[model samples]
Target: MDQRVSSLAPPTIYVVDDDDGVRRALAFALDLDGFEVETFESGEALLLRDGLDAAGCLVLDERLPGISGLDTLRQLRARQVALPAIFVTSHPKPLMRDAAARAGAPIVEKPLEAETLIAAIHDLLRGPTR
Candidate 1:
């Protein structure tokens, strides 16, 4: 973990989902786990934000209205953002998983299990290789 414990800040988790219910549920779950969280309705909203590096991880839905999750992840990588991210979607095809792996992002399918989601969150906190 490349985290600085003395920074006086909790690790922030950014959750980006176009669906209102999903965004709310995920945010609630993360918050309940004592993580600082920020929720966004779309990739474009997140793209317009500043200081993304402050976040410890990003939990993003693979499909979005504009600038899809994969594309957003590509942009983030292009910008050299090192934040760990996990991609979630209803359609977790082999090709998508391969691409995500290539981009250093991991995939988590929808109907997300509590255990799996928490484990992924831990893995994100653990760092990229985990």
Candidate 2:
């Protein structure tokens, strides 16, 4: 494959959330917004996936069934997956905020507005928030 060809491909957004409805909604919205979206139901499922480096970003839920989103981020970092990430959670606690900051991932709270989440993704893609 040509380098130029691959470079022209749409960016892939990896979404890790337990809720089926959220995943479907996100995938649909993001696709409509002209991005390639992949959905994972758990941190464990995401961890099992290959080519994490190929993704443009990750939108993760703070509380997951298998491993919390924070832990998933930790594990990904441990494996040297440096993709930009953000948390989409409802009312994240202070501790989670601190951890997310430490990890350099911004948190966009739930009841999510497409514009807000999209803006966050675009901003993070442009440059690190920190």
Candidate 3:
């Protein structure tokens, strides 16, 4: 993942996806949109990162190597991280869909439309009440 260091810090969007292509593509796109993105290949990696409580948001794949996205989010929430999250999935199962709803994260289906993800990020950045 690419992070453009600037004198002015942009909003931080932590992205966790196993697919290197997807992770790098997202970092490139979000970077253009003026976000400081840090990427991870697994929930374990993300979990190990510092400063998630101060993060702006998260974009997580529904499936991962070690922990599922839901479990990752749950652990974060359990720690009271409270960062808003979006799930990107190629094929979403009904059970997972239901769980995502319970988690209060929107699912953006892949072959991802950048606009959709960007809009969601903006909305999340607005506030929890949005």
- TM-score for each prediction? 0.87, 0.91, 0.87
What are the per-residue Cα lDDT tens digits for candidate 3 across 1-29?
A: 34455454678999999999989989999
Top model number, lDDT: 2
Candidate 3 root-mean-square deviation in Å:
5.0
Candidate 2, residues 2-116, lDDT tens digits: the string is 8997688788999999999999999898999889899999999999999964548999999899799999999999999999999999998899999999999999998998889
Task: Report lDDT (CA) for all predictions.
Answer: 0.83, 0.91, 0.88
lDDT of 1 by residue, 1-130 (tens): 5556656576788889999988888878888887888899988898888898555898888999988998887888788787888999887888898999897788888888756887888877876452
Q: What local lDDT score does residue 60 receive in model 2, on the 0 to 100 scale? A: 95
Quote the lDDT for 53 in model 3.
Answer: 39
Clashes of 2: 0
Candidate 2: stretches off by over 4 Å: 1-7, 53-55
On TM-score, the candidate that comes out on top is 2
